[model samples]
Target: MRSETREASKNVLGSPLRACCHNPQTGYFRDGYCRASEGDMGRHIVCAEMTDDFLAFTKSQGNDLSTPNPDYNFPGLRAGDRWCLCARRWQEAWKHNRAPKVVLEACHESTLEIIPLSVLKQFAIQAMN
Candidate 1:
């Protein structure tokens, strides 16, 4: 059953992870390891359930912008935004905790364009779990 489950997951998630597994510019896996594209570089491993945890943790840290005097600075932030600036702050915290290869690679690519905070929040939420 475990093997079957693994196979099922592989079938579902294998493609995108494989496609984004390598840094196109560098021709190397985001983790700095060199392997054929067929190899599992473990790049796209993140869960969706951790969003609430990230939200709660950031709120507890006093960075929740919904509260007055938010712990983090959000220069251009405005009121009534659905996305919490605090959540972006939490992602920054998560980034510092450990340098995952895939995330490092994504960061590298992110500089070329703006990565939306909401997308990042989703990624962080998925990653934590």
Candidate 2:
């Protein structure tokens, strides 16, 4: 279900959440923004840049993100493509040291509920630079 009071869409930094990607039309709502509301069981709110290792890791877990799914209209992910990932999935990948870089400005603040800001900072794309 949804939160009693809808929170303003913001990022982990408490700023307005930016679009994660429009190319693949990411997001649980397929609106290119990392957000979640009622019925979003997966909580796809983490803006993560795809990587081969991460893709392989997810595929091994039975979620083959790299393979296109025509039924879902998914174009399949590849290294460098940004997508709205599940917060718990990113945490799992982080535990395995296979997590991809995150775009903090695009990651929904709700992600902080599953992944600490510090841990997310460790994998921040801006931090890598």
Candidate 3:
């Protein structure tokens, strides 16, 4: 593989944590990197495990990710899937007691700039390496 290919396997923090998931798509660049840039207003850095409650919560907020959008190449999401979610959205869910389990290693480091590690640990997916 090329150097670029190998480098993308690492998280935004420069660690070799496995990608969050890709079946339903992820990453700000859609490369499964969960990376952020100036253009990414949402700062999608949280690697969250999907659940029915969280899905419903996001849908109620007007961002229905579970509904497939063929025009956008989106296949939608289902329970048990891992996704790169916007930091603020995840925080909102947490505030409303609907947060999902987070995969720390898979999460982009930029999340630390929004929410603290302490809060993330409260909903982390323990045992992930």
**Highest lDDT: which candidate?**
2
lDDT tens digits by residue: candidate 3, 1-129:
112342454553457655777666677777665665677888777889999999999999999989999998888999988888999999999999999998877876667878888898888784233
Give TM per candidate.
0.22, 0.91, 0.84
For candidate 1, what is the TM-score? 0.22
lDDT of 1 by residue, 19-125 (tens): 22221211122332212232333222221122344445555766442343324332221221223122234345466552111221212222112334344433431
In terms of TM-score, which candidate is strongest?
2
Residue 27 lDDT, candidate 3, scale 0-100: 75
Residue 38 displacement in candidate 1 (angstroms)? 44
lDDT of 2 by residue, 1-129 (tens): 363222468899998788888898998888888887767899998999999999999999989999999999999999999999989989999999999999998888888888999998998885112
Relative to the unseen true structure, what is the C-alpha lDDT of residue 109 in candidate 3, on a scale of 0 to 100?
A: 67
Local distance difference test, each candidate: 0.29, 0.87, 0.78
The deviation in Å at residue 117 for candidate 2 is 0.3
Model 1 misplaced regions, further than 4 Å: 1-50, 66-81, 84-90, 96-129
Lowest summed lDDT window (length 10), candidate 2: 1-10
Which segments of model 3 are wrong by more than 4 Å?
1-17, 126-129
Query: RMSD of each candidate?
Result: 15.2, 3.0, 4.1
